[model samples]
Target: MAVKIKLMRLGKIREPFYRIVVADARTRRNGKAIETIGKYNPMQEPSLVEVDSERAQYWLGVGAQPTEPVQRLLELTGDWQRFKGLPAPEDALKQAEPKPDKKALFEAALAAASSEPVVEATTPKKKGGKKADKAEKSDKAEKPEAAEKAEGGEA
Candidate 1:
């Protein structure tokens, strides 16, 4: 009964999640497992891998062979290195920092906006766009016509 450690596919199509488990080598990819060790989610930004080191070491000691992909996952978790008596890779153990909450970010932006001085425009803006321009032109035209009528009366 050749024992093996491998991944069991889960989650929806095109969005894969996996369970790291120990099972018979001849069984199906997602068949019943003797023991579930951890989970893996590759869809995340940094990818998520969790494994029980104690269980992994014990299984490896008892002659459980890990599949290729499962071996990479175990390496990420440092289980494979520890099982093989090798030094764990430093970068593999580092986790990404948690993102700050949106509320705090919003409040910080509001604070920044409030601290800045507001400058008023020197010239007043016209309320009516083309209508105001047309009214000014009509007033000038009327003023010219009235002057011509006065000059003609004087003559």
Candidate 2:
């Protein structure tokens, strides 16, 4: 059976978690996984990723393919590097090059900021007026005397 390393989406809406698994390529996205190799939580600061490098390398050697995103995660964790061998000298040389002039960059940013038009930070007048109207209507709808009586009775 053809196997793949991929992510299975979990958690609630707006908050997502993923499990890295080795599964039959034909299985549904979140269906029966053959083995859970790791997990990733993107909600945390810096994100959290845990992978089993030895198992991952073994699977890759055995011809299990990793999906693109999972491949990136593996690369970030350096597991892929170890499996594929170190990067070429050309890549290392490119990274070793000196950074551009910071003073020039700062001056350019200052010029851009000065050229940009300043705008008030307040909400747009139309939306602000409508929101205020809604708040006033809601406040009028609620009986303060009734609220006071409820609080007084509770006390």
- TM per candidate comes to 0.66, 0.55
Backbone collision tally, model 1: 0
What's the number of clashes in each of the models? 0, 0
CA deviation > 4 Å runs, candidate 2: 87-155
Show the colliding residue pairs in model 1. none
Residue range 1-155, candidate 1, lDDT tens digits: 99999999999999999999999999999998999998989888778888888999999999999999999988888888888889998867557689999999999999999998998898998779999999999999999999999999999
Ten-residue region with minimum lDDT total, candidate 1: 88-97
| Candidate 2 local lDDT, 78-105, one digit each (tens) | 7777778966222221122457799999
Overlapping backbone residue pairs in candidate 2 total 0
Worst 10 residues of 2 by lDDT: 88-97
